[model samples]
Target chain A: MKLKKNLALSETGFVFDPSNGNSFATNPIGLSIVKMLKEGKDIELIKKNILNEYLTDANTLEKDIYDFINMLKKLQLNENETSND
Target chain B: MKRKKITVAVTGLNAIDSPGPGVPVIRALKDSTYFDVRIIGLAYESMEPGIYMHDLVSKTYQIPLPSAGKASLLTRLKYIHAQEKIDVIIPNFDAELFNFITLADKLKKEFNIHTFMPSQAQFDERHKANLPEFGKKHGIKIPFSKMVFNVGEIPALKKEFSYPLVVKGKFYDASVAYTPEQAATYFNKIAAKWGLPIIIQEFVIGEELNVTAIGDGMGNTIGAVPMRKQYITDKGKAWSGISIDDEHLMKMTEQLFTSTKWKGGLELEIIKNAKGDYYLIEINPRFPAWVYLAVGCGQNHPEALVKMALGEKVKPYTKYDIGKMFIRYSFDMIVELKEFEKIATMGEL
Candidate 1:
């Protein structure tokens, strides 16, 4: 799963797809995950960082992260939606 | 003489395919010779192009949608008023007018925010459902209209309305139906979006004429400009329009003001038939999306509205150059996500 290179993600969680002119606003953690994904961070690494920083257990964090990624895909923010790795 | 500086807050900044009157209203305010204005844009969405148009809107704060109800709206406005000290507020959206009207008196007493608008009674009378009665009461000819709650009611509409009638929502959206089946389908569509009581009206076939006018609280008109839409968008909004000289249209506008004792900005949507009679189709209590045409024609309705809100004596505008035209165009600006972020997260930018 990869973040779209065409998507402009701001520090404060505003996402704009210049290609389609669609804009979206996400929460703080969502912003962090998008930034990490843009940097080509692996799911395990992103999961580890979020679990350590946020007040959540491993299972819940995993679930939440996956849910958010699914949402990104649904919103067409993912570059390669079917990428398994 | 130095221009007196005052802060003004305006809503309805969405300048899109279905545009709002905010940007052009701000432009009119900016052109004011008397007041050097600081514009505070009240936006409902972060991406409303007006929020990012820094040259026109000095700053923007996202307010809760009217569907969220009035208290939340007031709280947000209170926060904005504390920061901006807004002297006047011009609300442009039809959906949000009720909330603003409800807050009008309190805004004046508590924060001294002045708004010039029609009374609650006048506002209610002009609603799409109520327009037939409103036209009747004011001695204006209106196309026969009936309110329907269910698809079953659509079949019965053939008695009063002919084929190719208009199906309208309570607040927005309208579709022309040439058959009962089409009317039922459009009923479901409009009712799904805007909710119950879809309005069915006799579709008057004629040239559409519009007049943007402002009325003093008393039975006096402060400004009136008549125009014919040259081009219309798919959403039924005027894409290009021209000011025209029409005595009957102007007289009808005067009669409406006299009868309603309307206050603030109003746009009369009229359809003139082959028999040369005008029918009142709709009355938008706020300025129409094509309000800038009024400015282009030299009426400057929004500016005059501000003057009235501030309690200045404004004489009725008697003359406007006929045949002035306005053609709207869209521009794509490279807005940084940071600006969008501030408005989304912090609710202000």
Candidate 2:
């Protein structure tokens, strides 16, 4: 998806993706998702990696992960589910 | 129409006494003429508040956080607090929202609360593969993508999708391998944990757009705004954003919302490629914090949500300033640089 380049973030996990001009106050987990997508990781991969890196459950993590992915995609930081993944 | 006190359930890890989104939204609804407002939170940690709750709270209660293994009455006591009259549960996170949706029917019947949530099937529409499913049905242009289950499938995926292809997991999976080797390395380390496949999406170089809206479960739109990201910080929150009012984008979003019959809050993401054609990307089924930025222009959504949930009629949002901006001027500038370097070094920054 088309992402706005005007991003402003803080150490405390505050983020503003300038492409859409939508600002967000994200948790550390949410921050990780943004970083991964920005690094070209697919939404699925980002969710997978985050769960592995953090000490959390699989199911709950998945839902939150899915929610965040939806957030990123809807924010236009990433496109919709076009992956054959 | 059921005439009952409107309830908004806000789930938290524990009863940490602090003024967060829940307090403000609850307080706003408390003043509404439509329904009585009560605050609810999930207890994950100890039961103590760092700060005292406001006097406006009519009643405050803590329901133990529900877990997959433990589904006890205490876990669901918050719903019962309304005593079959609780109307809404606004999950602040994925797990909570999933919980609310899973119990939507039961809550409606037992509590007489009209919960507007995406169905279990509808939840898939918001997954990583969500856009593809939506677009495939309606011909919404999206980038090429590849989803893989096993690491051995990497080479096969590459041949079909290409190098810049993004490796993806299910909805929230983020483990990646830019190359077949990286993908395999990650898979080898994490495969046992996930039962689902991962994906690799074609890296499309383009601009990003963010849209936020509140709907009444019908085609008519309530509070809404289209934003162009202006300033972004290192932590990934929109440090600053400017609201954009575009008809073409709004029209496209309207059609999708109507088709989905989406209720509650909604956000649509679209991007324009070099061809200048906008491709459909994703939809968020909740209130985006960034939408709060629109309040200055007369779009106060958190307030609108309170009004709507209270059974108050809201006028459609049709006009707003386009250049309004929000930004985090100073972040860990070094961290920002690192991120910029990561993207730029790869020619993506």
Candidate 3:
């Protein structure tokens, strides 16, 4: 999944969407994945990177990543995947 | 000239849509020319923005919520005091005021933590449940009101209060209802959140004015500034306001202070009806979110309060700049995850 092009992400984990003037915050792990997504990393690559750095198992990381992506979609921070994808 | 350094602890740092006054009060204290302050922020949640604003707050410790009662609050405060040697604590939330007020004397005696607040009698008299009697006793005009425990009593309110009546919760929230059914609906809504003893009152229609003032524990008003809200949010908080020159409002404020022997900071919500009469709507026992506006007008009430708490003799402020306007703005502050993790895990940052 890709993040909205207009989203402003800060190193401090503060996310601001100028489109709606709404701001949000996330944990360290969430921030890492969002940064990877913004840099055009796919879900498989993002999961592999998190497993390499963090102690969690791959299955748990997979579930958490899905949940985090769902939350981002709910917050409208992720752009809908188009037919080109 | 060097300024004396003093450490002060303040609560109510949640500067959300409807804000708590703690942040503005701290801003004023930091600007004081008389003393340099080291601020200790006491927060209930890890995500309270004031806790993350490192420049505004020296350090923040997460404290137990007021619902946990006075004992839990004191235990947590004692721990903070052991480390910080907090000199004064300014509580800015109404829900937590009771516990702080209960422990005020003990705090002063045991730890030398000073708090300038209204006496228990003064606080009780100004509650929404007792405003009618308080108005009569103090000779102040207030809207006729009655307290009801259950929604069943709402249907009978028609004989006393007319249409477009205000249904209010004990601590917060209010809805204007045009009929008994609507009143009952709001009654249940408010009662579910703030609990029983819901207040039903005659809805006064007029221009709303607010006065933020501080009393010197004696029968004197230390400082008072009146303002008219120019823009209000949907939650009924003042978003932008302008200071006004009103003699009648000043006189009423002095009367309330003198009659009640009020101490510390308070906000007087007043309604001026069609007949030119002023009705006191509510008396919030602590500083309102717009307190910095008073400091902007040269009153510097929080500074005066700190002086009084330190046992300094302070004279009443007699002048203020009129027509000064304040518009509230919100900005995003980038916060590091490590800082958030620290507060969340260790409960202090």
- Give a tens-digit lDDT track for model 3, residues B48-145: 99999889899999999988999999999999999999999999988899999999999999999999999999999999989999999999999999
Clashing pairs in model 3, backbone N/Cα/C closer than 3 A: none
Q: Tell me each candidate's TM-score.
A: 0.80, 0.61, 0.80
Assign candidate 2 its CAPRI class.
Answer: incorrect
Candidate 1 vs candidate 3: the lDDT winner is: 3
State each model's TM-score restricted to chain B.
Answer: 0.98, 0.72, 0.98
Off by over 4 Å in 3: A1-85
- Residue range B106-167, candidate 1, lDDT tens digits: 99999999999988998999999999899889999999998998898888887887899999
Ranking by lDDT: 3, 1, 2
Candidate 1 residues A1-85, lDDT tens each?
Answer: 7887757788888886542334699999999999999999999999999888889999899899889988888876776652212
Model 1: lDDT equals: 0.88
Instruction: Name the candidate that leads on DockQ.
Output: 2
Candidates in order have lDDT scores of 0.88, 0.56, 0.90
Candidate 1, B34: how far from true, in Å?
0.9
Q: Which candidate gets the maximum lDDT versus the true structure?
A: 3
Per-candidate total of colliding backbone pairs: 0, 75, 0
